[model samples]
Target: MKRVLNVPGIAYGGDYNPEQWPEEVWAEDMRLMREAGVTMVSVGIFSWALLEPAEGEYDFSRMDRILALLQENGIAADLATPTAAPPAWFFRAHPEALPVDRDGRRLSYGSRQTFCPSSPAYRRAALRITRALADRYADHPAVAMWHVHNEYGCHNAECYCDTSAAAFRVWLRNRYEDLAALNHAWGTTFWSQWYYDWDEILPPRATGAVPNPTHQLDWRRFCSDELLSLCTAERDVLREAAPSIPATTNFMVMQNFDALDYWRWAPELDVVSNDHYLMSTDPESEIDIALSGDLMRSLAGGPWLLMEHSTGAVNWQPVNRAKRPGELRRNALAHVARGADGIAYFQWRAAKAGAEQWHSAMLPHTGTDSQIWQDVVRLGADLQALSEVRGSTGTAEVAIVWDWNARWALELPSQPNGELRFQDLVRDWYEPLWRAGIAVDFVRPDADLSSYRLVLAPNLYLVDDTGAANLTAFARRGGTLAVGFHSGAVDENCHVRLGGYPGAFREALGVRSDELFPLLPEETVGLTGEVAPDATGTLWSERVRTEGAQVVASYTDGPLTGRPAVTRHTFGEGTTWYLATRPDPATLGSLLDRIRSEAGVAPVRTTPDGIEAVLRRGPDADYLFLIDHTGRGAEVSVSAAATELLTGKPAEDGSVTVPAGGVAVVREPRE
Candidate 1:
């Protein structure tokens, strides 16, 4: 079964560190929480030191009170296992708990997420701690879910110590079994990199300003897998003790951590949750948050939660800017519009003093009467009043394949230009569809892509035979497939797949380029097209020849001026389109419009360009979320009159203007 969430109400509140405060303050925290209408609280996030103050001794005295306090206040608590950091005692007792740098330097812990993933000592201690916590709190009525660990990722992929090197060899052995296969996979023939023994394979060349991207990339993947193995270890222990308790790990939206193979990790999770920080109030910011919400929800096709977010401003970033008065509400509603089952802020109250002292919270240290406090109260009240909206599903027919393995392997190309980045390519292609109100899912390449009308894969640089065959079968069965430049050049093992770039997809894509023209950061190319009035686009330019294809756009400048920047080839009832250059937002917007028109893409509503809309279908009725990102009021036209859920006002057939950074959840009766 696809993973799914069942949210009965808008999830509220976030990380609460009662361990950081005096015992007397816990009561007031609960009292203020009642005023803000908080329904949940995440406890023991960074309490590893308190939970395991000594090596062999374990303590839950403090967490017992925290959980009891949450229950007393009638609030559910997201209980963490206090495993993000093993106390200094753990590292001191077992030096193996500390991570080793790729340069062979032993790392000393100063902050969280500092343990070495491959260390059996660390794993043993972590397992003991997780099991202890589960045994104590599994039956606690207030303990709703288990938050596994804080953002899981390697701070520095530099564990070349004996333990890591040995682990790396084991990982390679599992992947290729022997040195001969490893030699062939890594293409050791050219550089005499062939290994006669398993011990000869070193952890990708580490240390330096510009390290070997491919090796570093593999190391990153290995490290992520190592981390996943750690999570799975603890997960097994917890599931054994408390078979029914939900388990989740918080993720940062922009941060890349192969933590658990998302495809593998997601199914085991009860609800996928993320911590998102939106620095801008731009359309891009809204899209980023919405996409994150979609991804989290899509993980198991269940209701996901906003695990952590600031109610106002944040202090961790270089620039700490505060959210405007209405910005918080707009952001929260937008998450709901996508597929969020629950909504929560980063903290219940701001820190009196700490690294994140100034980060915004529902209740500032000033108590519960501030503007943010009042806004939280109003927002909570709104959520409580509209409990009927929970369990609503966003209707999206389009699903974009998002492969974490492809993201890891393909971007680590040995010879690709710096201009091409995996994440950036995804954003450039994804942003337009998002703004156009198209529901886009991030699917793995191996996932069933036949479900969607149009499947767009941007910069598919690493195309394997199985993946190529899947795409081939997808197109053969009448599915429109589109791909961008620098794609299908290499295999999973980092070797050029030989015959032509895009190896197996050469027949499907219908064109081949002899060489890639790398562009500098400042270099610009021109898009020659007569689509939109301001539709010309530019980025990197690629010279290409097409077979059984028609040119839609050509480069007007550069040596490859007349080459087809955009080409289309029709096969059977479906077609394949290749975009050889990066196009600006306007041009991409026009191109996506063409695909939408031709492929019959579905949109929730036909709103103005910058104003995005989504339809949430429920058993009784349908709801539409109209989000205005212009930061200025917008005149939005409605197909028919509908009642605004956020405000009890009636939205009519005539243009209903919406305020800047504002959101409206309107209920439209099914026709």
Candidate 2:
């Protein structure tokens, strides 16, 4: 289990498209892959058109040479099912397979994922190609892993077509079983929209007025399930061919793309994999990467694969800013530090001409003289040194609750705050924890929280009965619970909790709010309590009336001036706190630091402010990874002698000096 690739070390190559170049270039690519210490390459990600030139016509000559080439060079192939993009001929043959947007416009072919997930024609064609690929190369020695499909639901997540309408009706039948239950759950009596028969229901498509909130939420859930079902179908085909090879589709588990609920999708795959890219606009991309890696690790419950990342810049951003010198190494190693068993990129070589021509790769158009190429070689050697840490696991002192259903229900129309983003609120709490060098794990709302000392719920707008009870029980059982603003206001049906604003968590947090008062975009509120005197809040405020809670921070100025801005409630044996407003970073950091001390939760390692420290435990050794996010060097004190993986040198004086923007992984042998 030490080597996820079934080899000696971590997997290091990326998406390899041999069809993009000439035959002569294929040989050169293989030579370079060996020189760069590449272990495996994902093939045929978007090559459906090449594989099947027309409907029912197959061509494996190009792929045949490529697989043979990989076998000859000793590099493994991550063979992919080219179902993400069906051939143009297939789309032409079945025009109804194209997805229609919610606005009633049928999108034309030409882009990837043009087929509808619920279309029978599309499903049949997709499976046929998957069967062909699996039949041809299931037993090939060069194939190491069976990549089921590319990133699912990236472009065409939802469809309002007639085919999808039928599928939604079927899914509703299975969920509610009867029209009475469906009507009751949807609150159909409110607007006289009750359905006497299942045929009366339609997707919450473009309408004259705002559609029912419950209907809208169910539509999104159905869409996500449709895609998951397709992914499972394809994986079944591959499994029938070869069950030993692990099969997975890349999950987009980062910011801005929250289509598929990975919690529901993770169980369908043989192995969990994710594709993470840095935001060119965000100054703190490293923290975002760390959080994404942690989420992937938590989803897999152990070491997961970093399926795709960018070596420098991605071509899709409006302003594609390339990574500076040594940034790629820092990003890759940070993922490894957070439990990524392997590191890969979007592409192995730069495209000569395509939609992604501007995307950066390990072997850029500038050849082996570029900074990316040099760093790629160095990272390969670094991963080789870190091979011994493949199977180790990362631990967390704190857990953040994130539910895709709650996130989907929170962003519906007609809310207190229109500009409120789910991920932004979660990141606001996560940033401070990362800066303190605290290892954090993300879990679903219903996940068991007894293992973590502290749990934070940041804007969980929709709470099911099980989740609400779980949160309350966790607090009652002596775990510190911190609930953020606008949380616990609604149930699974998107219906308000009637009695109070923060309904589900009011008793647990010992606070109540009958109404929420949102501030203007430029408004600011000052706080007067344990935080710094100049501590301020923004975006939201609430008129708090405590039932059995003590005020921790009061609003000095705002709609709820001189009222409680934050509250602390003592539950059965633990303490619960409610955050009424989003505090600035420093103020939030101070408050969380104090709370951590009170909860007796400590970081993985104590280091300078911006340095990231993560510990991974193994049978014979414990690997400690120190990532210097700070621009300057950081000196970390070690309690015993250790071996630095990157430099192959022993750490002196039980101390390691991490260079600025550099990473050092120390392997400490167990006693």
Candidate 3:
């Protein structure tokens, strides 16, 4: 995969909609961009209406002038296809392009992403605009990369209209190829839901009883594929027209809204870019940001781009709280520390009128005099000074298996517990590692695990034979493995693994469960053993029977009292640990500490609670990032003697100090 652009420093600046304002303001915008050390700007994202006022009518007068202005100002342009939100006139000409909800209600126009993914009219219009953009900007000096349709599948992931229904049937036919295979995979014999023909299957809609679990799972897969197909279609157009320019579409990573299978989509793009937003309600929002950056970097297999992040507040959230002083710079550096070669925001300047009017920008409503603008300029200078950190990659010895199919299967109805959420389980496992400043990489279940010392598979409810074989081999090869509750219980088709709970890896895990005992919302149970004597377990507990595993922790209360809450078993040369219940933070930390020690997985260097230390290594040098997320000063110990990049001072004693809500970038000599 392509790791960096042809440019020198980290790409700065963000989305610039020059068409939004008058011609006079455009020059001032360019001046401000150069003053702030901006190198790139994404233009014409939502300018479909202005580009093509009517069907078959193309107007590039405004876009041509905008590209020329960027070239004159010495700024690279990430040209967009402008097919995200089609103009109202195109929809009026072909109303069938609009999307429909689960209740069969056709959604009206006015909102963005209103078109159906499977609609031929929408595809035709989108491809036409893409071809035009590629043809015009292929040889333009200002164009650096091609930004495809904006955030595909963000608003319209699934449509329950006739077109979508027909498409779903076709997809199923292609996958199953025969009704007998479909029936066996879906387990239709029990509910008399057998399908004799291809047209019988429908998108899982709101019905009297919950739709078939396998059917719902397949629908989700189909929906993700449909959106991916749309992206690939536009990508093909740009590839044919402008073979030299790289194409990418921003991804909303770790967000709960869209269900697109990014694991499949990541391979098709030249660069992986993500738009991340901070959650104001969560106190540990920094960890969330780190997780997102790490996931994006892993998807790209190297340094990626921070496409869009808010400067302060977002308009869509219920409460748009502004960032504290220095918080924005800290967040931007956090992404850079995790392997982001570029840092960009949603927009350059605040919008005067739009759906995202209240969203914060680099240049806020208060203009250049505002503190936000000052911070933006300072960050720009900092990025320029730290340009040597480009093309570097982070190294991680821990891998966490993240499977979208397992997540989809866990959401099916009639599970042991309805309150169980897949993301919560993942977060529970990741928080401890994040707090310890231990770097982690997110990988698919089928990915190779031979490089990592420790692997965590949390809530891997859906396990195929290949995944089971991989985990078993990893354990036998002396790699430490940890499997969480409700894992390895079902097959790829959401069918039970017949003999016992967690049947696929019962022998590898060295444990078996006859039944799942889900606790009520407020119920709690105590745990007592060598691992965590005073810690408590809540949310879930299972009656476990160990075959060859030794009980590490046992329940002290609840109906399954005296049973094994946590178990450890020695395989050939390594060990596998299993937790049959959800433990509290203290208990989870204790378990992780033991595993970390056993696997020889240590942090880069220990710091205070709110200070984070991350290392990115290149061929010639190593970059160490120290960020203080707390509101007080922190003194951190560096792993080696290095010179701070921001301030050319050497910390030969392996210690440095960071102010409250500040960041420090140090370049260590490569050994």
| TM-score for each candidate, following the candidate numbering | 0.93, 0.98, 0.98
- How large is the C-alpha RMSD of every model relative to the true structure? 2.7, 1.5, 1.3
For model 2, the run of ten residues with the poorest summed lDDT: 1-10
Clashes of each: 12, 0, 0
lDDT of candidate 1 over 383-486, digit per residue (tens): 77556677777666666666665667655545556545676788787888887788777676677876678878887777677887787678777888888877
Most accurate candidate by lDDT: 2
Residue range 94-165, candidate 3, lDDT tens digits: 899899998888998898999999999999999999898888888999988888889888899889888999
Q: At residue 430, what lDDT does model 1 achieve?
A: 81
Clashing residue pairs found in predicted model 2: none
- Candidate 3 achieves a global lDDT of 0.88
User: Candidate 2 residues 85-174, lDDT tens each?
Assistant: 987898778999999998989999887888899999999988999999999998999988888878999999998899999999999999
* TM-score for candidate 1, residues paired by index: 0.93
- Give the deviation of candidate 3 from the true structure as CA RMSD: 1.3
